[model samples]
Target chain A: MPKVTIDGHEIEVSQGTTIMQATKQLAIEVPYYCWHPGLSVAGNCRMCLVDVEGPPKPQIACYTQVTEGMVVHTQSEKAKKARKGTLEFLLSNHPLDCPVCDQAGECDLQNFYMDHGQYDSRFDEQKHKKKKAQPVGENVMLDQERCVLCSRCVRFCDEITGTGELGIVNRGSHEEITVFPGKEVNNAYSGNVVDICPVGALTDRDFRFKCRVWYLSSQDSVCPGCSQGCNIRIDSNLSRPQHGEGERVMRLKPRENLNVNDYWMCDEGRYNYNFIDRNRIQTASRVKEGVVEEILFEDAVDSLASVLGDAVREQRHGRIGVLVSTQLTNEDLFFVKKFFKTNLGMDAVESRFSFPEGSSDDFLIKADKSPNTAGAQALEVIASGTYQSGEDLIDKTIAGEFDVLISFGVDIDGLLGKEKLDAILEKVTLLAYVGSNHNETSKKAQLVIPSTVYAEKDGTFTNVHGRVQRIWPAFPPLGQARPEWQIICDLSEKTGFSVSADDAESIFSEITQTVSSFQGLSYEKLGKEGSLLSTVKETVEK
Target chain B: MEIPEELKKKWDEAVARYEEKRAALLPVLRLSQDHFGYISAEVEEAVAHYMGTTPVHIREVVTFYELFHTKPVGKNNIQFCHTLACNLNGCEPLIKQLKEKIGIKEGETSSDGKYSFSRAECLGACEMAPMMKINKDIYGPLDKDKLNEIIENL
Candidate 1:
């Protein structure tokens, strides 16, 4: 350990920790742009300049390693002057487009100008111009005139993705970041360049002019796109409904979790939140005599209870099948398992929903598309070696083994093709579909109940690595939709189970008491990063 | 583009000098620039393929250095010194004379494709003052007639 004093604050750090990393522990903010903790230090952006007691000139904090008993003054006159000069050089050619720039509220250049630089402009020459609004990739747009030449995006493409699609093309004042003449920056994680860009140079095409960042509220959540369970922040404008016709989710940003996806997420997980607002089941409905009619939430719950009660009274538990989805949270799965086993005495509960073949990389992506398949296994919702695959489930349904089928968050069209799904739907008597979206399964089902998406609920998901992470609600549930756990609890009460838990936190505590895999974990204990269960399997496969 | 077998052997020999393949990028680029008239996109891609890197990395290096040209040049490429020492020693008159006599500006090639001219920074011949180089040959400390005679002989 080396003891370093930064701005009169003393702290001991590891041998090779940089001055920027040490100053972070003392709550000293050193403005930077090109120095990302996740990427190699370029040290080209001189905004992190700090005065050292022994060094002859000011050094960039990102590249200078802290020595034992070294003294550093980050707010001294020399350091401040150096930072101001760096800011002046950066802004000398930067166009004044803050009012129209998407990164105005969160840009580092705008922030450092107010913090370290307050001088008048000294540049009287005509500002250099380059390409504007160039489409570089499928999801990223580039404005070359607004770039600060940080090389963050270029380094990101080269180092992180191992796809060197970007580079500084010219020299000196003519230097501009661009791709090769005919090639484009198309990759699995190309949208991350837009997130790593500290200025308005790169902007996301999906969220370009959607909404200003100041009007949106953010909440920490886990991406349900895959089993990697990358941590993310969901930004939504819940109050302002007049923006884009009830589309609440403005964008999804990567939340830094060093153990998980550290400061970076794949484009699939980053842009997967659009389904939360599009093609959603806003209200409950039921099919009556070949005509679909919207029904009340209480009526839908009562109708489902009557079907379960009739099956229990007639000793027909073997005919009642409940098909759950791995997309449901751990708390939702736990409640569904307990209700099916203890209340209805149903032994046909299974999770036969298979996700489509999603692309995977050596990085954060996983071949398993479900976010909580491990949690489903841990809670015994899908029993080991007894659960049927998606095709087998469709075969079993067409054979008339299960007269009453209950599904949650499982897209039937995706599992089996439309022909097979339609064949299975014709044989089932009472089909109750509970999901977030209006898919083929919900359209043909006799009963359709809307369930809240992951962004509108608070729960935990056990990833492929068996690391549990918590998701906080960024906004209220749309229409009459409710969390699956709450809906399950209400239905259980209607069926005379009396689970008595109305909220996710209480049900999570009950789950911790009963489930051995979640024995010692509680909602409060599983902080934003979440705790890993002690009993993770050696090798997890789907 | 396919590099010649001799140049490919030279590139391999150059690559063998460095421990890491990425370190051989500059020398390999120089070799390609010498063999070809200039480093084109195809040449950059070929070098990147040979060095196990990307074309953007090769492009970054070629654009950063002043010696490597990315576009095609004439048979005789003339580089005029434009540093403070050369400017104070009457390099401006030589530049003007070349521009008028060659019927082309600093970065333009001649109509017959025999000559091309460009202004360059210091060539490390400050003692020779107003110096210029053409095809690996440096001539300096000369008047207009001496430069005209050299051009006429060429």
Candidate 2:
């Protein structure tokens, strides 16, 4: 270990650790632009220049390794002057349009300028102008005039995704970042560039001009887009009701979790948040003679409970069937087993239902499109060796084997063709749907009980890796909708079945007690970064 | 356009001279520029292919150096030195006179495709102050009459 002194604080670090990494241990703020922990160091930005005791001039801390007994100063007079000069040169060509820039509130250039820069303008020459508002990819927009030539976006494309669609063309003051003549940055992880960009140079095309970032409130959550449960922060527009589509969620930003996404998330998960507010089933509804009528959620729950109670009491449990989805959390799935399988003795409960096939890559995207298939597998809801696919569940319903059928966020039309799904709906006497979105299955159900999306609930989703991560609620369940776990608990209460759990935490506590893979875990144990089920089992054995 | 196998063989030899493949970029670019007069976008793409790098990286190096031309520069390439030494020795008016005589601005080629003019950095001939390099030759201590005569001879 090499010992280095930074700003009067002595710390020992590994052999190859840089001054910037050492300063991070001492809680010293060394402003940087091009130095991303996830990407390779280019050392182009001079913002992290620090004054060393021996060196004649300030050295760039990003690539300068700390030698043994080296003394460094990040806030010395020389260091501050060097950073001011670097900032002045960086801002020489940057346009003064922060009022209209989408990244104004969260941009590093704006933040660093407030922290380190207050210098008067000495430049009398006209600023160099370049292209602005160029759509670089399917999801990213480019404003060349605002760029500081950091090459972080370029490095992100070249190193992280290994898709080198971006490059710095020209030289010196005339240099600009752009793509090839006809190519676009349409990679699977193209949206990550906007997050890594330190200035207003790159912006999200979907979120640009939607709402000011200052007005958006962020809550910690996990992306339910795919089985690779990327940690995310849900940014919602609670202040502005009249924003686009009346959507509460403004955007989804990837949170840094080294075990999972590592400060980068796929474009599919980053933009999959529109469904949180679009086409949502806000209130419970009942269909009669092909006419839909809005009814109270309690009435729908009571009616479902009575039918389930009748089937269990009359020894007709074989007539009751439940089709579940992997979109439901682990707690929700656990409650489904306790109520329908354990209490009602329904043998036909299946959660092997499939979602639409999504495109995937080796990096972050998973072909299994749902978030919690492993959760269902861990709970044995999709029991091993049965291999009963979602199609088999639909086939049983179509054959009139079950008089009552309930779906939990399973879009039957998406799984089967519309005509085949309609045939199944006609065969079942009481078709009930409990989901947030309005799909073909929700539309034709005799009784529809609304459920909350992953954003509007607090639960744990066991990702494909068997890692149970937590998701905190970003908003209250929209309108009269409730989380699926709470809905299941209500149905259990009305059907003369006693459930020991009331909320998501209690349901998860019950799961930890029952499931072998989750024996020694709790909500506090599975913090932001989740614990793998295999590791949890090992800990319990120890 | 595809790069020739002969040129690619030279590039392979150049890459073997350096420990890292990226260090051979300048030598490889020089080989392409020697075989093909100037580096077009297609030539840049082909060179990047031969170098096993991206075009933007090659483009950055190509545009940074004064020797590598991106476009064709006719029969006579005139490089007017415009550094501090040449400017202090009154080279600005002479550069203006030379551009006027050639019927072109800086970085512009002649309409007849016979001449090219570009303002260059210090050409290392400050002793012969107020100098301009034409093709393979350097002319210096230039006045209005001397610059016009050089252009006339070209």
> Relative to the unseen true structure, what is the C-alpha lDDT of residue A342 in candidate 1, on a scale of 0 to 100?
67
Off by over 4 Å in 2: A354-356, A383-387, A535-542, B143-146
> What TM-scores do the predictions have?
0.96, 0.95
Q: Report how far residue A231 has shifted in candidate 2, in Å.
A: 0.8
Docking class of 1: medium
lDDT of 1 by residue, A499-537 (tens): 667578887888788888788888778888877876865
Find the number of clashing residue pairs for candidate 2: 0
Ten-residue segment with the worst summed lDDT in candidate 2 chain A?
A533-542
**For candidate 2, lDDT tens digit of each residue in A72-153?**
9988999999999999999999998999999999988889889889888888999898999999988999999999989999
